[model samples]
Target: MRRRLLLSYVSLVVFVLLALELPLGLSFANAERRRLTSDAQHDAFAIAVRTDLELTPGSIRGSTALRAMLSKFAARTHDEITILDSGGHVVAATAGGPALGADLSANPAVQVALRGDDATREIEASGDDILNVAVPLIAGRDVGGIVLVGVDLSGLSHRITSNWLRLLVLGGIVLAVVLLVSLLLAQSFTRPLHELQRAAKRLGDGDLGARVKVPEDPAELRELAESFNATAEHLATLLRSQQSFIADASHQLRTPLTALQFRLENLEDDAPEHRDDVGGARREVVRLSQLVDGLLKLARAEQAAPPRTDVDLRAVAEDRCAAWWPLAADHQVTLETDVPIVAVRS
Candidate 1:
């Protein structure tokens, strides 16, 4: 029961943590991704506006200045910058790997920008994500080219991962605390029940003194403990009253029975002609006396039993037979005793 309760508590805590943290973490990561995308798009649009200003026909000076600006922006942002001409050729680039005249028109983002639509996407580059933002460069009614910006997503991913790990750590700590509290609560609830069980067992085994101590918390359990104690006390009182009555009745009967036996003996001595009647009456008195003795023994045994000891049944039987031998002779009967030496409870 304790284990089940603890498991239930931990399960609830885990569910709550998942419900609260999963969406929060997902939203935080998505927000970070959106922020990166927005920044990339803003940089792309700014570069396109600058390039548009220098897009005049037969302007080599404008192209050189644009190249210099692209280099500086790439160095500062740690992102790739490419300016493509209307013929889908790269006009200026910060990195030499793509070359200045490389045809990048096959790229989806570039193709979308060439069609005069702003495009943004995540692309895999060497096992890491890169955010690509593209904007069309237009001067009046003529399409100059496109500006492509590619930003590394490593820093964003790292920040999201770090924040999620912190959340997981916090969740773990809360779970630990919940586990501890659940165990304590389980113990508090079950301990009293265990005590009550033990007390009931003792009472069933005839220990009338057995009782449960009521706990302070959980009103129901305390009430149960109190009820058990009350029942045990009442039962003990009833048994004590019964034993006292039996003991008192037996003692009271013994005196009158003794006096009656003495009177019968005197009557037998005085009236020889009625000896058989007197004998019969005296035997009845003896039987009554034995009955009273038995009642006394029973009452004492019920009140307080002596510690157990082994008794020889053969000796007990022989003693009983010897005691009844005079009665057997008066009745003109032969009494034979056959006994075995066996151990019996006394």
Candidate 2:
């Protein structure tokens, strides 16, 4: 039960954390991507501003300076920069191992930039994600080359992973704390129930004094404990009263029966012919005395006096059979005794 309760608490916490953190993590990733993309677009436009001469057709002198500027910008921004001619051919690039002179017209962003539109796209390259931003170079309403900047998602992915890891660690700590608290609470709750169960068992086993300590908090459980103790005490008092009354009545009745037997004996001496009637009355008085003695024994037994010795049922049965043998013979009935020597509680 404790394990189940603990699991229930942990599961609820995990579910809530996941529900909150999953969307939050995704939003954080997307926001970071947009911010990075905006910065890249700004950088691309800045580069395009300085590359007007390079973008002009047949401008050879500015090409060397443009390459140097692109290199510096790429190094500062950690982004790959490429300059494409109006024909969609890569003319200059900041990245090493460049695809110089490569026909980029097939790419959607390059085609859009060629048509004088700024374009941005996310694409997969070499098993990694890359963000491509294309800024068109406009030369007084005439189309010029395009400036394309590509940013790898590795850094973004790393930052996102780092954030998720931090959240995971924090969530783990919270769950641990919650688990500890749940365990402590479960112990607090079940401890009282365990005590109550033990007290009930003892009470059922005739230990009327057994009781459980009531908890202070959770008023309902406290009331229940109090009620149980009260009921046990009441039952004990009632049973004790009943046993005492039976014992007292049996003891008091024995005195009158003895006196009546004495009077009968005196009457028997005074009247000899009525001897049979007196004998029968005397026998009845003796039976009544025996019955009263049995009642007193039962009352004492009900009082639960601690046993001092074990009784053998086989010996007791044999003695009872022997004692009743004469009466059985007079009634023409057989009295049998076939019991094993079993020790019985007194």
Candidate 3:
């Protein structure tokens, strides 16, 4: 049962940390990705505004004439490059073939430029996310077409994954540390309890001397140990008293019983003339029997323990006085009791 409880506590901690860390860490990572994507879109729009263009049928941002300029601007940005014309055809693309000269006017991002409005979109296409933004080439208020630039999101995804891995690692380390500390603490607290268990088991096996080791200070655990020790002492005392009672009873009765036996033997063997000595011997035997009875009562005193009921001290004192009243009248002896009715103390 204790093992189950320990496991439950550890499991609860693990689940709680996972529940809190997973979403919080992911949200933070996603927010950063979104910010990066937004920045890429804006950068693409600015690049479109600055580019030199012609309605001449040419590669988009891929034109040999503008490649140097586009490369110069897009270099080190991790942004995918693209150029769109007034007819909304992709004239150039920095990524592989399928992306080149693709019609983008129908695209939600291009539709905004077609309506003469600047627009941007962060989209997943060809198993990759692209943040695309478009701007019309305004050659003196006459729009030649649109210059569209695309930014790839692979790096963002990579960063988010890396951050998540770090968080998971940190969580694992923290959990391990917490569990180790908890185990150590539990052992410290449960050691005394284990000791108590052993003592009780021994006591149950008829070992009355079995006792807990109690500390001097009266802390809770110490007090419990002391109580158990006290119980053991009391039990040992009772057992010893019982043993002494048996031995003392035999000792006290043996002499009288022996005398009785001897007198019986003499009465059976002697003639009628011996009857007088037999009668005196029988009287001595009776006196011995009375002494034996008194000794028996004294032997039984070993079994006496503190009574649960409260006894009236004054009543006991008065009873003692009454017993001596006749002696007091004859010899004028008196007994007094001024002690309180208090329990015995060490």
- Summarize candidate 2's per-residue lDDT along 206-303 as a digit string, tens digits: 78788999899788889989999999999899988988999999999999999999999999999999886677678778878998998888787733
Q: What local lDDT does model 2 show for residue 55?
A: 53
Q: Rank the candidates by TM-score, best first.
A: 2, 1, 3
lDDT of 3: 0.69
TM-score leader? 2
Segments of candidate 3 deviating more than 4 angstroms: 4-12, 52-65, 95-101, 136-143, 215-219, 257-346
Model 1 lDDT tens row, 150-171: 8888899899999899999999
What candidate 2 gets wrong by more than 4 Å, as runs, is 1-8, 57-62, 97-99, 140-142, 249-346
- 1-346, model 3: which lDDT tens digit per residue? 4565568668988998899898978897879877886776677666665565534443233457666656666666756666766677766655442355577777777778766677777778889887777766655555556767676777777888888888889988888987887787667666777988998888776677788777554388898998898888898888778768765886868776886768666784775777645555565566567667655655554333422556676665665565555556678766666867654331
Q: What is the Cα-based TM-score of model 3?
A: 0.65
Q: Return the TM-score for each candidate structure.
A: 0.74, 0.77, 0.65
TM-score between candidate 1 and the true structure: 0.74
